[model samples]
Target chain A: MPDRLLLAGLEIRAGERVLVRDGGFRVDAGEVVALVGASGSGKTLSARAVLGLPGPQPGVVAARCSVEANREVHEPWSGVSEAFATGRLARFRREVEARFRAIRGRIVGYLPQDARGALDPLWTVRRQVEEALALGRTPGRATDWLARSGFRDPASILPLYPHQLSGGMAQRVAIALALARGSRFLLADEPTSGLDPTVQAGILEEIRATSAEGVGILLITHDLRQVHRVAHRVVFMDTGRVVETLDAADMDRARSPEARALLASTARIAWRAFA
Target chain B: MRATLLAGSAVLWLVLLLGLAGPFLPYDVVTAVDPEAIGLAPSLDHWLGTDHLGRDVAWRLLMAPGAFVGPGLLAVAVATTLGVTAGALTGFVGGVLASTIRYLSTVTASIPRFVLVLLVMTIYGSEGWLLGVAAGVAWAPALAEAVHQRIEVLTRAEFVLAARAHGIGSARILLFHLLWVNGRRMVGRQALLLFGYLLVLETTLSYLGGFGVPEPEPSWGNMLAFEFGQHTANPWGLWAPAIAIWVTVLATGIVSEVFAEREHA
Candidate 1:
């Protein structure tokens, strides 16, 4: 897959139930793929699988997964059972984990679902931004990224802590942290659910801006309006499966009952009330 | 709040100063044994009255900081250091290691730690350093448990996930980002709490006459315990060490509550 993140076969199981089974999807560079479904459809879990997080699950298996062509595709537990059998111990999986960590923030940055609590409550905005910059070893470029994220006077905002900032502002800072790594792939999980409607639009604009700059965006969300506004394509998922993938322009033509139900729900949310 | 914090800090600094200055203070009355001065009421020559052995009670009271505060500080330092290290390692590197640490914390917490302090002093002899070691060892599990929980919560935090995604190694994330950065406030609170705990432990252990600095070396615990030993019901002398202990404990608690809160924006 050229300029895309591809996962051929991915399975995640906790104790008994598989959260995501036989699931795979891709987000090409500069493309936005919104994984839309009702709660617990494993949309967020599927994105986490890309980050090598095994979830709260005991085991996760990914036979093939990749961010772009020629980039290493991690399979953390591919040989786990085999490693258990040969008495060679958990060595292969350790290497797999190390390799996975080596690529995490640099290759892929995540904006977590819980925006209000995403930044450490104790850390100043400046300190957090500096840390993110320093992680990529470009510590002096805080103002550059802060401006890119749309902060007009970064000096004023930098001294404030997470709790001091509005939910919308905090979300932008989180996005800035992710982009600070110069990640090619961005994972935005419910990035705007808990913010003011006006603020939500601004945050979406930031995400849109990031995508326009060529970052592949995997937008995991339930709001279909966000899907229409930001996503280039939507992956309709239900009960641990990728039910369908269609262009955002074709969302009205979605045929699956789950897709129709989600679209109908989004339509039912009156925009006039927000106005 | 600011007033309480200031007052508590003043008391704490005073106690610390006394403890550090213990070596320079005149301690002649600690070993003074005189039948003539026994149970003497307060006189200008013998301030705060003399104890049963005629030792100057004020001089002994001055020794309280050195005898109790020193050991308490050492124990809190040792326990917190060990606890933070153990908690960070176990929490950051999960699997058998995390499980094992969880089990160890459980085992240690289940024990009435004070009993362990007593037992160690009983078995290892009544050396002051040994008592301090026992106090530190006994409290390590409590700190370990607190830090373990803090680290686990932080590991799942979105910020930490962001850090990890940035290709920061697990060690850096655990020690610097998680433990030091996120966990420092928690450690401060724990330190203050442990200081109070050690204060109580040292006093209690000393008063019970087991590892007490042994009468001549004057500690708050023995000062109070010394009167009850002689059945002398003089409130003036009895109240001296009692008030010291109470003030120290209260100051530690107030300071912790007021100042140990994490610096938030």
Candidate 2:
């Protein structure tokens, strides 16, 4: 009913170099927003800034940013987390952090780009998933989430460490960690980047199924084909600025040169696949 | 290297054996001084001869571990706890606070180690706790600086970012994830190095004649003090205690090297 996430009047500057100038977007509950772009585009930085990864470097500023701490309860979420405790990484306002604290693992989840590297190599899958649940204060069996994330045999997989898991399996475990925390909105940053196509398809299907269940996802990917197939709205970015926003239906009519180039590249990939 | 390791292990084990046997051993170092046999060459009756006080040099060497080991262990334990806590907290919570801590450690470290020991000695009255407190304070700053550098590197590690992204609290992440996971081996190596420092410090104090356990206590340093400048003629009196100190220090050095090598492997 309300916006799940919002970013308006955003400007990112590193020294004299402006990375993102006048960039902003929003996603309501139960919607897929795929941010598409080329290399050195501001897509990843935008997502990281929202997630509060790096502190605003010494000479940077943000105009407006807000996240729905709990969409169902209508709690307030405002102010950048960098201000909470910079060296500690991400921490929001006390009330906002408290509300979001109640919501994360249950309402919002983050799936990092490097799924295998994201997992602690020394820890078993079971321990990692369980700790996520503990941190999220979510009540669910870890095995159920593992299965929900498409693990056929969670019992066998849970005992293995990250090293023992194949690329696809590690990616799935990352998803399971998100689901176990009660994630209704997933911020997946290239969930299938390095996996084989078959595995990539399976992962995409899981994401689609997640969306079908009314969970909003801000899918960060460079793949236009995946964007066409999954994203309801495509927000195209170029050189750190949001240059175009298009409905999935109007992709062929992409107005900007960058968007058109993305379409053409995906067209080439599709042709290669068929030929 | 293997032979060095064996030699080191043997010297350490021999010290431990003598330490265990010290209270029960037959030699009465203070009263058994054979005035007639004083400065006699090494023999069955007196295995390493006598000092100027006519006390058996071997008897004192055997008894010295009790005096040396307790203070060394105390200093190491206190220094490690303080150093690790100081370095870890400073490194994790960067900014003005980090700079302030770095400044404090620099100030503390800049004071010469011997001066700091003397300061602690004067405060605590130079009794059993003297060496422990003095050396503990003296050693902490350097160890803290080393750990600070190590933790700073870990802050940039991907796993650390991943942990923060997952909503793990800052304290848990700093302690369990960053410090505990990586700092364990480095702490152990620091302990071995500190033990060697404490031993060397205590012997130096005894050799200087004012700071150690005092007269008739039989520390390696004081035994050397008793025969100062006489080793040219009565080398046995000087060399016995000197060899004990050298062997113990050398053993610790070898053990520390092996520890580092094993870690790299």
Candidate 3:
């Protein structure tokens, strides 16, 4: 199988502040890549840059950024570099919008950090999921996907707006909506941040099961426990740079000072719980 | 609840319509002064008694809704279109354009509405169209200011941003979605409020000798103005037209309040 996404030296900046410096990673088909970092560590920015959320800043340069998928090399997702060099950000924005429309619901799904904010308040849960499916599929197929997204009582949910739903239910609806697009890559930023531990585990299990079914996930989070539970590959970032990458199995044996420190802290916490 | 409110307003509106239409049909001539009926008081022949001019008070009351209601409705329509459109556009397209329009509307609104009406009457000569134009000019700025504020609130809503993100064109978003969906309430409320103001403005204009051509034509305000001197002799002469104005304004208020409540619900 081909790699779902390949990034080389992806750089991001916000005005004069260099938020993400020379970040590069790839998720092969059917892989879950957990990007673990502390808060303000550019993990979210990297994900946002990949998803083409905010346009890039001036004077930001990307040395060798390229994204390849399905054996076709897409134009460099270097929004900042283009803004600085060509001053054609408006044209570039149109191109990005067009590209996003084509690929977002078809090949890439984005799970924003705030699940409530991700959903429209006025629309019912099922309608939101239906909208996501409609973006990429035939009407009949979209209905089928909505049904399969764990909505057994789709009729009831279809009429119940977002405010009426529980937080966990809302997050599930967000996930279903994202998945309904039939996207191959899921960029989930803190998929279970505000949920209780039990709900978080349940959500993580769903994410893991979904990833097993040919979905490549770039999981942006700060939870080390979650990293241990579901990550197939680990990319540790610090201060806007990808400092280390390791197999999930070999994460304990990693020697980079930052990685070792993270592992050691997590180990102490685990041991303390047992003790 | 909504249905009940709407039904009640509909009934009130039906009554107003009947009053307006009652004059055009074969009824006692409103301005037919019967000298023989002078000081005759309410009787079988004159249901609401005769004015000092010996005109049937009932006929005058019946004719009152027609003269004012047509012009009021017309003024409301013109003012609403101009006001809401200008307001929605200015508010949605913020910055220099919005500020300039806002400033202009403020200046217009700041001037006494009666002063503006007098100015318009001076220029346009108190014909029915001029009456409507005068009332509309006086009313538009207030309605526009209201619509502008409402649009400003809706422009910041998430759905609008989402619509933009969907690559929907600005014009479609403003017209098909924003204007009707979010703006209907403000416009409806303004129309009702303006209806009351329209009555008062028309009455004021007539009192100042601005409405109707010469003798046959009669306005409720003109009748009231004529009867003001006769208050001690026959208060009903003044009271009849005064009551007409009061009922119309009250009906307008009730209908508008019901509409606003339903919209919020």
Candidate 4:
């Protein structure tokens, strides 16, 4: 009911094989909700569905992909998709897709899993951020966005191409571009996956600060430690479905066997590092 | 490599000047076919000597470029635009459309392009524009396949995926990112190769006669075919167009290579 992003009853299918079944989650304003799962758990697919993105394979239908934002509800396939004729469904999809396009970037921005690879190799940092700003019609300079993402000297960073930047720097530039859209919510997918711990902590801190500024974040990651650090709530997924949703403080109390196993694995890794 | 590129480019420029401006040159290839001056060796009155028709070989040689250059440009433009667009679009929006394009391209590609061009010229007549268009259509399938393959490989690249995820529209992605950014080298290379191919094709058809650039048009093909037997009388007629074709094709190839090298560097 609060200003939030909601996705429910989402089903993604490639032909007859189901990828994600009945995936659902919510992130209210100023809250960080981490969607955590092992590799191949369909976390990214479900997140992409809210924006009406089809999978790489054709006929990867995303049905009942419902998005709620700014108190308006948008369903890509209203009611039962199977109930409508092909023509009617196609028309309905077009209508919803337009709305999804409008919501994307402006209302909800997406951060790709690979930060360095995701930044356009040909584009300068300034150009990339400016494009995002231009697309959202957000009035601001690239330097401001870069500064907000933690760059000390944004002008120096502006002229540099993606390859010139270190991995952490590229990630910050990506974050700047994502935030430059004036996005109210962000879908950060594995934002800190390949960074050193110091840089990881810095990025987590940036995410926390962004949340503090009232941006609802749906963080998709495999790191339970990251969930403990910045998330208000955690959604545990296995295979393709959400298995558990629990408060960050109560992750230790999660009862799902998959959740406990994941916790145990993280715990063992942490113990080995300390030992 | 540098010297080859420079020499090729210089020769290319002179050839293009002759081909494009041949009609306006101060010599009459059409009405100057004097029977008295037939097969005259190179002299101050007639540069490069007189051909079997008694027309100045230099004038006819200059006019010859128009036969291939114009049609070659047309073919490259048509083929690159059609081929790149179809290939990139289908590859970007995969599934049924991609499969259909691939299937169609495969079928079209199996038939030799020269054969198809021969059929088109036979049916449509040997007009330059018609030949250009026919050759463009004949060549588009191959260019399309190359572009499609490039797009398929880069379609999943993280930058492309990120652009989509950020809500950038398909047109901008295809135009700016795919074509302009990542695809310029390949497109440029393909366009150059297409133009070279078209030049050769046009020349070959004209040389074959009847179904190519008609008589009095002064194509390198027909000139070579007509004057090669008379090389003993005047060698320049045979050498002029032959050297022109060689220089043009070599220049295009070298230019394409240089462009690719610069892009990589």
TM-score of each: 0.85, 0.76, 0.77, 0.85
| Whole-structure CA lDDT of model 3 | 0.71
Where does candidate 4 stray beyond 4 Å? Answer: A11-22, A55-88, A120-126, A153-165, B1-17, B29-56, B92-107, B154-157, B213-217, B231-235, B259-265
Sort by lDDT, best first: 4, 1, 2, 3
Best by TM-score: 1
- Candidate 4, residue B184: Cα displacement in angstroms equals 4.4
**Candidate 2 wrong stretches, greater than 4 Å:** A1-3, A22-32, A54-106, A120-126, A139-170, A194-202, A209-214, A228-232, A247-250, A269-275, B1-62, B111-128, B223-265
Compared with the true structure, what per-residue lDDT tens digits does model 2 show for residues A1-275? 55477766566777789888767667666788898888778776676555555544443345566666454643322444355336432333445445444544456677888888878766789988888888777788789889888988889998897878998998899888877766667788888898898999998888888887777888889998888788888899888889898787787899899888888888998899999
Q: Encode model 4's per-residue lDDT on A45-153: one tens digit a residue.
A: 8888767666323334444455556677656545435535344555455565676677777678888878889987767888899899998788889999999999999
Which residues of candidate 1, in runs, are more than 4 Å off?
A1-3, A14-18, A55-59, A69-89, A255-261, A264-275, B29-56, B85-111, B227-236, B263-265
Best by DockQ: 1
Ranking by TM-score: 1, 4, 3, 2
Error of 2 at A162 (Å): 5.3
Give all candidates' CA lDDT scores: 0.78, 0.76, 0.71, 0.81
Docking class of 3: incorrect
Docking class of 1: medium
Interface RMSD, candidates in the order listed: 1.9, 2.7, 4.4, 1.4
Task: Please provide, for model 3 over A175-247, each residue's C-alpha lDDT reduced to its tens digit, 9 standing for 90 to 100.
Answer: 7776776677778889898899988887788788778887888898877788889989999988889889988
Instruction: Tell me the deviation in Å of residue A45 in model 3.
Output: 3.6
Q: B125, model 2: CA deviation in Å?
A: 6.2
